[model samples]
Target: MTTLTKNKVNDLIMSQIPSFGSFQTLREEGLAFLKEKGLPAMKEEEYKFTAISKKLEQSISDFSPAGKVVLNAETVKSHLFEGFDGDIIVFNNGHFDSELSSFQDQSYELNQLSESSPENLGKIAKIEKDPFVALNTAAFEDGIYIKVGRNKQVEKPIYLLFFNQANQGQIITPRILIEAEDNAEVTFLESSISLDEEAYFCNMVTEVKVAQNAHVHYNRLQHENKKAVTVNNFETDIHRDATFTSVVVSLEGDMLRNNLTLNLLDSGCEGNMYGLYLLDGKTHVDNHTNVDHTKPHAESNELYKGILADSSRAVFNGKIFVRQDAQKTNAFQQNNNILLSENATINTKPQLEIWADDVKCSHGCTTGQLDEEALFYLQARGIGKIQAKGLLLYAFAGEVLEHIANESFRKHIDALVQTRLGSSF
Candidate 1:
């Protein structure tokens, strides 16, 4: 085992002194875990493309509690949930804002991490291993803990909003944990927005646990400030016969990286993942996803598409793993990209590792520019070049957006994609 000096671990622990009072034990445990395992090196296959060491080298500071921000109801409605109905839970810089949050009867419980019970803490501690996860477990002051009871269906979705209004050169970490009990159905929309031009870092971790026979839909909409850096990690556990769907839409940020993992623990489980990224200027976005089939008869499907314009770049790495006992497993994955400029670049890799003999798995990825033949055909039919390109791009992205079961939400995302494509498109 790799070892870290005691003083080094203590010094790292000291950096979190401001937000380190309540969770001191958790912090020490995390420090010890890091000392034993050390940080993931560049040689680690999973972290090869993502150079997290540079990020960890930066000074670590405590994220002060941002009590609340004055936001007009109209502005909130306009920015989030333009065409959907849901219970809204707002967080300003990692702290829950009860004043701006609204909930229905007892369909769900919304509480802060600081107010969570010992039982919940035990659950969170069970999965805290990665350096970032350990860091979040060590220094997270306040966040949201949502639970949907058994046999209950949340008719309205739950919206978790994370807004960053930090000073320049500041960094914020928003940590959240959600649990859906057996036979429960729920939809969660998590958004990250910013209102300043600061170079802040929003390092967030969200852990979700889905009980047997439960259905859960989790969507992440990241539209942080153009000058900010955001790294989000989503980890999910799906039990017997459960279904979990995750969709991520990223539009703005300087450097953004998302790590998503779905673990199928029991038979007859289903997992779906979809992502859409639109980047321009000098923005860089990376999406790394993993799906693990641990039990027999599990199924998973994943599709990710990107539109890169200007001089932006995007990277996609998706992996599917089937254990030896996971017989009769079925998994499919595909990634496609469209480069709008000569300088734009896209790197995509779809991987499948199957140890079971009876599994059916297939994976493929394609990256290419817009079809000139199709563009010429449309232009020849009296369509303008800009309009023809826009139409083609819309059709290229339509397949993935069609997976959204909600009509209104689908239309909303469609419009957003069109608007982001700009007038020239």
Candidate 2:
């Protein structure tokens, strides 16, 4: 492994100067924090299993911001959802592509990051500890601001399509802020993709605020080119009695690190997070998620599954923190991985830090191969070996996939999973 120092990361951050308008101070703080901690080193507690700093250094050593790539509707026609009817917002190369977006709804508003109010822009996304958030806040080229008005329910899911269509190596930072007003309800589906097998870095941050009693269901699908590297952070603040759910599906990438956090700021909130990573080749995926229970009577549930093949690797670090005042809190976490190849690697840790007496919390992790007995039984019952293995793996991953509320989207994911495993049945 190459030695990637903190100074080199900080130098890269400083080289790409940001032009933050009203949020300059926020960016400055992120720069300072990045300089202090640098990128996550392998020796760090949270990053011990994955050498993220090295991956980032290699991907972004000659990083430069790419110019606008001309994309028309026909270019992305094959990538769009076939039968889904929704408002689609497109971001090309980390910048909002208004010409490509098909959003004309009056109930919701989408604007550039610089157009948002200074007082509200940096309130929900605090960058005190995470340098990545600070870096995104300071250097993001362009992003989307989505606001669902009070008491309104969006009839259809709003789709955020982020496309990295580049032919060279560069770094792209995309920032997003979403706010759902009190009593509002919305569904969001976000997908990140790279059209070509080009080496690039996509650093993205999405901050969401769910107001009192608001309900949100967010689906994140990452299927970037295998030659690309992606670092994504998702932070959400749930208000009183609000419900927030996130389902992340990782299909392809060379190296990916996802940091997902949910903060229960008010009482009686519910947070649910689920993820599935199907990896092969030399792909590496790291998912670090945290749920903070700061209020009483909040409940949270988490489940993540991984299917690794060849020499791929997967890392999962899930933490649940119930503060002193978070009484009557209920939290549960489970991570399960199935390795199809002997060389596949998985590191999973489930952590619980609870100071509340009345809380019921539990965490567990399991990593192993498929059940040989079951495979043998299926094979003896006239099923082909490969088919039996595929069936077992499908059933194993279906637990997390079943949580998807959208039937169509769930089927789409199921198809992708089946294709990945070469399962014809």
Candidate 3:
């Protein structure tokens, strides 16, 4: 760390003396760890492919406080789904903005962390060796906590929208916690966008807990700018007879890293994750997912696909662990990528560690260009080269998009995918 930047970071760290009252201990530990470890170097094994410490110093040169209403309803309305009706929770510069948000459903509990103290706030997403997680824990601004009652079904989908307008290069950390009680069902839609083209850094962490016989559908749309850098850490735990599904779409960004971890705590649990990233220009996107099958009769399915264009780069590392006691477990993972330009780069690793003799597990990865035979067939049928390529690319991306269950949200994502491919092709 340079003298100037180190001083800035140290000043920020010292400013967080009386952090959240109940979270003081966690914050102190996080601050101490961050001061000792600083940031991950480029030589680190996990962050070798995607380096962000230098990028953070470059993009986030200074710090500023942000709690103002930087966006109006009209500007915010343009980002919402055209015809979708749901609860809209808006956060400006990482703090909840009541004037810009509305919650119509009273069935589920949604409150700011500064107001309510929940038991599972930092349980699943415990601070680990990651510097980004520690930074978020020490200097988090505001957060949201959601809970659903037992056997109750939330009718409307909860939309968590975040807009960053800290024009002077700010580092924003947003925290979220969700709990689905036994036999409960709910859906969450999370998205982030920058109001300006200025550079900024966003560090986010979300933790979820699903009880017995419960179901949770979590979807995230990454709508970032060319100057935006993000690090997302997501952790979830599934109990007996519960199901958890997540779909992540990365459309554009300067540098984005996602660390997703899921653990099956009891038997009869199912976890599914699907991710799609469409990159162009000098964009970079990395996804690391870890699934641990600690109980028997649990199944996990993960499929991540990417289409890289121009000089863009992407990385996918998926690992599944089947413990010795986790018998009769079924786990499948696959990562497929396509490179359109000669300068495009991809590093994919699919891993499986099975200690149970009665388990069935498979993992593999594929990186190549679009199929020539298919392209030739499309062009041979009177289709233009550009149109044919777009069609093929969209079809390749459909495998992950089809996992979106909501009709309106699916169409919304489909439109975004088509527009992205059309421009690139």
Candidate 4:
């Protein structure tokens, strides 16, 4: 286990100066909590495979606090979605960029996080458990707030683009809050891009609340510089008869870690999660998801897949909890991984804890290489070796890709996947 001295952690916390609203209480509390309980060490079972202390130490040691970054509109123009006609909210170096943001109508309200009330801001998710989230709550300077009014069903999707232009040895923490009221429906898309080839750290946290009968579809795309380290945490609360769906895709980054938590707070709530990761080089990706069933008749389903090559490493840990009162709950979880290189490593675990005797729950995990017989079958039909391998991997990944509802975005992701698999030929 790696433990940092109080002086060192205090120095790290004092490195950044917040320009947003007064958050000294959160900062002080977070610093105290961090001092008492340092970063997750190797001995910690929850973070055994993807320990963060060493990497975090290095990143923090190299941290250089930066002033507000001035970005030209044309410089980030290429990062926008090609065919999506929905609203676009852009964040430049963790700060909301009003000039780059656009919305379709007044069906929803968009504001800066600093303008929101503290009760409304931090009530959705608890951050005391994770030091990363506590640090984010302490240090976040600016963020976005989105709220869909009651009975508002937005036809177009809402896009959130987080563009990072950090210099070497800098860290950016971006925060987001979303609330979907009763009977409201909306689709949200989140994508991150590292503009330069600077080695930096990006920490992000998003909190969502879905009211009764509300529906929300959320997709997060991570395509950053290979030298950058990104950590994202998502916390959501689903109310009665509400539904929440999340899809996460990680394509490029030095190290990526995601912590997703869903709370089925009321009866008839539904939660669904899906993920796809394609990693190569020395990249590392970790995904940890937790779903809590607190009421009866709630349902949750989770599926995650990974393809690792070269010396890449990946980890997936999913947990489902059914309380005693959560009778009639149904939950399912699965994880699948494909390791293309002998040096690549994957650790996956699907866990289910059911206290209610009247509930149905199941979990499974699998890790294996691509089927050689399938490759041989394709090669026998005059296909080249590389082409056959690409075909098989493509088919394996297509099962998840085909579930994407956005045709244009799905095609874009498909092309990227093909390029990664060398199937574009």
Tens digit per residue, CA lDDT, model 1, 1-425: 11222344345445653443355676566656655565555576655655544443442232332334566566566666457777888777777778777777588777887777434552532434456566556556667778889988888778787778776534576777788899999987777878667666666888888999999998777777777777777888899999999988887787788888899999999999999888888777889999999999999999999989888888899999999999999999999999988988887889999999998999998888899999999999999888888889888887777776555566777787888774623
Worst 10 residues of 3 by lDDT: 1-10
Q: Residue 161 of candidate 1: its Cα lDDT?
A: 74
TM-score (C-alpha, index-matched) for candidate 4? 0.95
| The candidate that achieves the highest lDDT relative to the unseen native structure | 3
List, residue by residue over 1-425, the lDDT tens digit for candidate 3.
22334556657776744455777877787777667666776687788898788787777765554555557898778988866779999988888888889898877888888778788877788776477787788878668898898998998888889997666556788898899999999988888988878878888889999999999999999988888899999999999999999999998889999999989999999999999999999999999999999999999999999999999999998999999999999999999999999999999989999999998899999999999999999999999988899999999999999998676888999999998898875
In the predicted model 4, the residue pairs found to clash are none
**Number of residue pairs clashing in candidate 3, backbone atoms closer than 3 angstroms, sequence gap of 3 or more or interchain:** 0
Model 1 lDDT at residue 149: 91
Please identify model 1 stretches exceeding 4 Å from their true place.
Answer: 1-13, 18-22, 33-44, 51-75, 118-129
- Best by TM-score, which number? 3
The C-alpha RMSD of each candidate to the native structure, in angstroms, is: 3.3, 2.1, 1.8, 2.0
Q: What's the lDDT for residue 168 in model 2?
A: 51
Candidate 2 lDDT over residue span 1-425, tens digit each: 12464666567667775765766677777878777766667777878888766776666664466556777898756677666778888888888888888876677778887787535565676776466677677677667789998998887888888889655557788888999999999998888878777888888888899999999999988988888888888889999999999999998989999999999998999999999999998999999999999999999999999999999999999999999999999999999998889999999989999999998999999999899999999999999999988989989989998987666777878889888877422
Rank candidates by lDDT, best first. Answer: 3, 2, 4, 1
Q: Which of the two, 3 or 4, has more lDDT?
A: 3
